[model samples]
Target: MYRRSFALVAALAAVLVLVPAALAARVHVRVEGKTQTIFGSTEPTLNVKANALDALDAASLAGEFYYHVAPTAFGPYVDQIGRYPALPGSPNGWVFKVNGIVPPVGADQVTVKDGDTVLWYWATFTGAAGPLTLEVETSIVRGKRCFFATGRNDAGRASRVRGVVFTLNSRRVGSRSGVLCTRLGRYAVRVAKAGAIRSRTYSGR
Candidate 1:
């Protein structure tokens, strides 16, 4: 009896140790073209274990935003997030992708794993949304950390925009013509063009 009790307690302790690891999948989420009002994390990443819908719910609860999910034959469909609703007679709505690929499953069914990125953007299904992709490349030039940004359309074609500004922590640091200098702390870098392009934010170290 004493041996069985000791083994039971040891097994319970082992399960407790493993439960947190299983529940702590890191996932990055981005809601493009909207003001950053989600959980006050760095770039809206889910450091805890969560599915796609779970991440959205956590953000909505933390940010006090509204989101609706409708039951469909396939699964739960996202009807509206915040003030944006699916447009009638159009494919415009909240479309999402995991790891840069559009998944066939609904957000509720999509299980997010560690190091996976989930992007939710509000735009028409048509390719004219402008700057569907944005990336910041960092390198060391002349012993200084430099950042270069690029924007691309849905067709994977690059975009040419004038006066591309790089903002660090909401402050404009430099333009596209020049390399941006970095600071010690983590900075949220946003690059944008006027009118024809949508802005994208990336984390800079």
Candidate 2:
């Protein structure tokens, strides 16, 4: 009995030593809600603890937005964010993804590693499984400004986004040939479409 208790105590000591180091890790976070990008779109990279909810908590404190989490059967559920609430049969709600995947568990249950990207956005749901998301990438080469955009569903499946438009430095520009040759300089770029969550801003120099 004494040997078993000693082993248990050693295991607990190991866990206590590991947890604090993980909590200080850096995570890239983005909050998209309502009519515009709330945080991390044009802002700097965010710092978070070890879960998706921790990233949201950091954004809420830094951006000074209101959010509420409720204890549910599955786990902790984020029911309200900013001015939007996940109501019964209402379209206004929130959805989240870590590294482009909708995690099967709740945000608090999912453990996030360093450099993981956590994105939470307000979405209007149609049915049970709806509301697509967009991922954007930008690059500059030889004075040519280029963008690559893709749309992802709730399942993290990707497809090309149709009729993609870019907001570069607050100027709206449309792409016809899948590439824009705007003069390359330090700029911030965001992609949008007709019916998807707009992407987090990508800055290029």
Candidate 3:
């Protein structure tokens, strides 16, 4: 009887251990217009266990935040903004370094938790090509998928080309034809044509 009781106790202990292990916490992340629901925690310290960093890193790369991550450790956090090596000789340019409550520009030191929003705004600039702007709005919505949209326009010398632009979010799973797909997480709007500004939504439900 003692042996049987011991066996039962051991079984119960095993179950107790397995139950919690199986019920791991999940962190859902959405990108562009597509929903990526994942199960895990995003604590930096606990990264060894589930490694939410990898998931976030993948999302960041696939989404609009790709530009925010610096080429080096201590470099242009928000390169898309006005003054960067990318935009040589650009005048009358500005970046939302500190807009609203969020710091538009951040270093690699910044830790993007599970529930965080990253917005990238491209304002007008003064140059020969004019203000070639590519704005992307990104955020993790309901921990389901990363949502984003991109709009491009030109101003100043290129003011005549101030109008609609469109790009595809191929990161979305099983996407076909840049249009008509849930894969439409974000857009890559560029001045499709010059002349007039025509606003349009290039995605679906």
CA lDDT, every prediction?
Answer: 0.64, 0.80, 0.32
Residue 64 lDDT in candidate 3 = 32
Q: List model 2 lDDT by residue over 74-164, tens digit each.
A: 8888998888789977777787898888888889988877778888988876777757787776676776876778888888898877677
RMSD of each: 4.9, 6.4, 13.5
- Candidate 3 local lDDT, residue 12: 99
Clash count for candidate 2 is 0
Pairs clashing in candidate 1?
A: none
The TM-score values for the models, in the order shown, are 0.65, 0.80, 0.26
* Prediction 2 TM-score vs. true: 0.80
lDDT at position 104, candidate 1? 67
Cα shift from native, residue 180, model 1 (Å): 4.7
Work out candidate 2's RMSD over C-alphas.
6.4
Error of 2 at 44 (Å): 3.7
